[model samples]
Target chain A: MIKTFTRNDLIRYIYQETTKEENTEIENALIFDEALCDELGDLQLTVNGLGRIERSPSKGSIDKILSYSKYYNMNAVN
Target chain B: MRKYSVSDSQLISLYKNGNEGAFADLVNRHKNKIFTTVYMIVKDQYLAEDLLQETYIKVVNTIKSGRYNEEGKFLPWVTRIAHNLAIDHFRKAKRYPTIVMEDGSNVFNTLEFSEDSIESQKIKEDTHALLRDLIKELPDSQREVLMMRHYMQMSFQEIAEATDVSINTALGRMRYALINLRKKMDKLNIAYDKNLYQK
Candidate 1:
């Protein structure tokens, strides 16, 4: 019996989150399934679009965590 | 001297044994990822910082209380904690899904700066700002899944566990989020990377 992948399965494949066995199946399907391959490409690009605007917290944010850790250590010691 | 090359599990064990700088090492390693993850959800730098501090404090308490068994999975574990805290803040205040406009302005706010000067930088900033605004426009549930999947970089399984949804549901939300984002971008006539949709 052939296994049919769902929309969810396509998403998992696009995100590279599938198991090895599932990946094999998806790859085999993608080889012959032009629509499926296009879906994967579109989803990948959509995910990529989200990545175009990466933001990081400021240095002061890191300092806040460090200071909190220091305080926790001091309190633990006393 | 601390073995700086050890795994997160080893560092965690060293911290458990009251090593001087082990905890600091761990915090330094994961701080930015944790902070950025929270900031993405909260959408406010100051509030995100506060939540980041709270997240660490909870981590400290959990470690001291002997309940933290997660070793190698430290980053995901703490990230879950941070994500939950952000949600909790929203629930407690009942003010979440609120679009935190930087200038307290309306939505559809556009760039006001000169297009001639620093064109590249301004375009980049505007793109990010507009995208941020679009994300804010998503329905709360869809937005949550999108943020966790993209910002936290969590797996569907991890996202399912964190949000208490099934993996299938998580995947569906992600799929819908992409579909919705595409539809919104089309409706707004916002130019995206067109090459993506062409092929």
Candidate 2:
């Protein structure tokens, strides 16, 4: 039986969020569904697009964290 | 001199046994994701930094109190703390409004970009900065899913459990996040490499 996939299903497939059985099911469904294939392609592009957006905490933040840990260490030892 | 290649679980155990330096190592290791996760949710750099410190303090307390026992999963465990603290801040501030705007404006103008000589470099950097801006404009729930899935590297099931939502709900949020990003990209006339998926 052919299965109808939702956008959520496409997301799970694109991100590898599905289980093995679900993956097999989605892969099997993708073979005959041109539209699903296209949607997957588009969503994959969006997913890859997200890689461009990167963020890191400030160095001051890291120092603050380490300083806090240092205080905790002093207290725990005493 | 402790080796720098220690695993999180091992470092955690060392901290539990009173080696506080190990705790610092653990915090340093996961600092980027934890801070980014908190910052994305709180949307204030200063407040996120405060919460980031508080989150580690709480983790230290939790481990000292003999509460943390799950081994080899330190990243997810700490992320759960970070997410909870961010949510608690949102609740206390009463600022988590479910406002979804159809038009992407105002928020996109805040990010500063540097000038690049190479055209490809310019496009790459601009696309990155633009996507970061658009992400801040996503609805609160969608943004959370995107951060957890893409940044924190949580599975759908793990995200659902951490956020206390259903797997289908988590999946739906991620789908909408991508779709919304695509729409914004088109609306803003930002041209990403069409063959991005192929590479």
| DockQ for each numbered candidate | 0.43, 0.40
User: Per-prediction count of colliding residue pairs?
Assistant: 0, 0
Candidate 1 on B45-143: residue-level lDDT in tens?
678778988898888878876888873378777888999999899999988645565643222122333433566444555655776677777887888
Worst 10 residues of 2 chain B by lDDT: B102-111
Off by over 4 Å in 2: A1-4, A76-78, B1-7, B17-25, B93-125, B152-154, B158-165, B194-199
- Write candidate 2's Cα lDDT for B1-199 as tens digits: 1245787888878987878788777877777677767766776666777888788777776787788876537776778789889889889878783433323322322223333345654455556656767888999799889998886778899889978999999999998988898899889887776322222
Error of model 1, residue B74, in angstroms: 1.9
Q: How would the docking of model 2 be graded?
A: acceptable
Report interface Cα RMSD per prediction. 5.6, 4.9
